[model samples]
Target: EKRAFLAQSPQLYKQICALAFEKVFMIVPVFRAEKFDQPTHLNELRQMDIEQAFASDEEVMNALEECLAYILKEVREKCEEELEVLGQRIEIPRLPLRRIPYSKAIEMLREKGEEIEYGEDFSKSQERLLWKIVKEEAFFITQWPEELKAFYAMPYEDNPKLVKAFDLIYRGLEISSGTQRIHDPELLIKRIKEKGLDPKNFEFYIDCFRYGSVEHAGWSIGLERLTMAITGRKNIREVCLFPRDRKRIFP
Candidate 1:
């Protein structure tokens, strides 16, 4: 019997390479089996995944900010004509996009008349409202509850209940999400068990931390989502030449 899965993201592979490379990046096709037929989702997509060793989530966030600014500048100069066709314009985001803690964001939403509670993930409409409240095209939401994040996310030293994870929200959508990963093998196994997952099933990945795994952080960006944000496309299918979703599979 074959034991495998269609890689949903290149997260594990990039982290494995970071063990020796220190810094690594990849853009690859990722597969998902979601049943959603939304305008912004597809069964197959492309993702840009990055991993870096001996880095904190804060350091990686700064690097990501610069990377996004550069991308916006390049698109403005190189794709002006194309953008015009799509009736869109790229607004170069400012450096160090605002950072709002998960708790504060919830408070802001409540003040603005949203009934969201702490530890709850934001829905699509809620994300839109949060973006409007901040009035920034790009911003970050950090300090998510540990239970809300994956077991690999590192917990805050001062607040073990919260993880050192973040989400990059752009124009009412989440373009990326990342965190400082747990590098201690024992802690990693503990977290896996806490999440009700069998650590034995992930023996290979867990073993990578047994010897000398270094502290690392990383994030994944969606190419389709970026395209949608830049071109002001309401639907992801508009930008994708051949989007594969629940209904369509062949060109």
Candidate 2:
């Protein structure tokens, strides 16, 4: 039998579309092989993705904030009764959500006695603690270390150690992540090699850029996780109709 795998994410497709179409969005199912059996870990979930050519990380972050705020506003106005039934009240977040640098976040965490290291990804508890400090319903953690982000993320021109990336944390959970991609084919290859991945494997992806690619940025939002944030659900499975995780796949 041949080994097969499901689509883990629409990242490649989105980038390709951005190169050709300038802008594109999709709501699709994504699969993950992670073995995490936690309240927020789902093997199969829905993702809402968007990509735009000639855009920066700040531009995409603004778009994401507006998109989320609009959704919450609509829910608050139209789903009042439904929210009442669920004993929840959705708050429309203010525009231009707070942006915190990764370094600053790490410093704040350390001050709060969190023994977290500088290049480490934030744990759920750390995220919650960050929420307590910022006290904002939604915010962006930006400029993550390049080592922690995907190879495609564009490194800062002044400081190559950090990448132009951001993660939107809503109610202490990372609902979306985005970055300005490296449009230069050479840079793409270099980043791939730096990540210990053979550039040959990403030949097709790199080839797309050789034909004159433009700078682009995009993001993906997990539908179930967003639902969990909006509905105040403790578990992501509660928001998913047929949640798939490490266990319980049957109806």
Candidate 3:
């Protein structure tokens, strides 16, 4: 398959399954061919993806926040010796993590002397700055501009230009990203075109919605980035046994 590419995420497939199953989750390795040389960037990585029908972004985010807290508590209590080996200490976040709007985040960043333009994704430095302002190990940034989000992200009701999406930022790193998906076939097509993507190529996915589909939302967690945060590691490669970044391909 000369044209075949590795799976970047289980998002699309999980969304499809959620139509029939109501809720679905998957944990698997994913690949990205992007050229990134950052400490946390990787060409191949693992992720935890979850999808649910009839759920709003807020509902899904609450679930994910609780999940993270539970995992962190367990690791703190159960992996004492292991953490000692790595000289890492994890702080379990409190329930109902703090949430900030993207607009507010931009304002905060600008106040802090960080030059950020609207509708553009935050840079790594900007993420760190916002994390400091929130004063929490984990926080959510919601109401992202629609143009900055994926094609499936549902635009906001009050302002159609912004999407009902949120990013889970942990310890200055983006640990998860998700949104309420556009369920209507017509709306999905419009979003596809808005994102400058071809609906014809996404026909298989689009056709599924034409029959019947429920409002759905989901998020995917970057396994390495999560590990890096939990372990207080500076680089994502440290968490993986065999890392694959912009340069490395083989052991």
Candidate 4:
């Protein structure tokens, strides 16, 4: 190992934390080295990474909903001017949001003359297609097949084809992705292998299961993306105080 990538967010760390503490949340900086350009695509961003053990995916979504609701309640009560500018005024969204599977979303898009391949994730345009119908939604679509999700998503029952996963899409953009995780050490290793990655890098993570771990799940909500949405900003850079992009860096 010459050089290694260090996580800015406590994603992997929190998973370990959940081993001892079943429910934990962290609002931290996450450094992503990919080239950035879109208003929402910054090289470095603030991420609210959370994972809960001994909980189901639905429970995790409910928790995230509660957190977002509390934030909005505070903002509306205090940040009147800001909310006025954004033209957003709201309280808690309903209990359950609209949950559509990737396969169904694809079919709907195809009806709109968009031929999509199975197992492929949605592109911006594809998302917008659904957004038009779900514009006023705070709900989520779940059960993206394992192939379309990260290795961490737990496989769904009766549907070994799909994973127990979901994305919180609001105002047409993905705000959060939460799902149950593979607690079985063997399954985690199998997932890692299926993704064509070595298991060595994740040895430390795998160690959690080797010891004793609980069955918990959690979701992460991108902070910058939330800012852009809440502020009604078209470009993501507008939300960040000092946004760092691919071509723009200085203040």
State residue 101's C-alpha deviation in candidate 4, in Å: 1.8
Q: TM-score of predicted model 2?
A: 0.97
Clashes of each: 0, 0, 0, 6
Q: For candidate 2, lDDT tens digit of each residue in 137-238?
A: 999999999999999999999999999999999988899999999999999989999999999977888899999988899999998999998999899988
Specify the highest-TM-score model's number: 2
Off by over 4 Å in 3: none
- True lDDT of residue 149, candidate 1: 96
Q: Estimate each model's TM-score.
A: 0.96, 0.97, 0.96, 0.92
Q: Give a tens-digit lDDT track for model 4, residues 81-161.
A: 878877886555665666787777878888889878888888866776788766654657787878888787889778777
The best candidate by lDDT is 2
Q: After superposition on all CA atoms, what RMSD does each candidate show versus the true structure?
A: 1.2, 1.2, 1.2, 2.0
Error of 1 at 117 (Å): 1.7
Which wins on lDDT, candidate 3 or candidate 4?
A: 3
Q: List the residue pairs that clash in candidate 1.
A: none
Off by over 4 Å in 2: 1-3
Candidate 1's C-alpha runs over 4 A off are none
lDDT tens string, model 3, 69-150?
Answer: 9889999999999899989878888878988999999999999998779887899888988889888999999999888889
Evaluate model 1: give its TM-score: 0.96
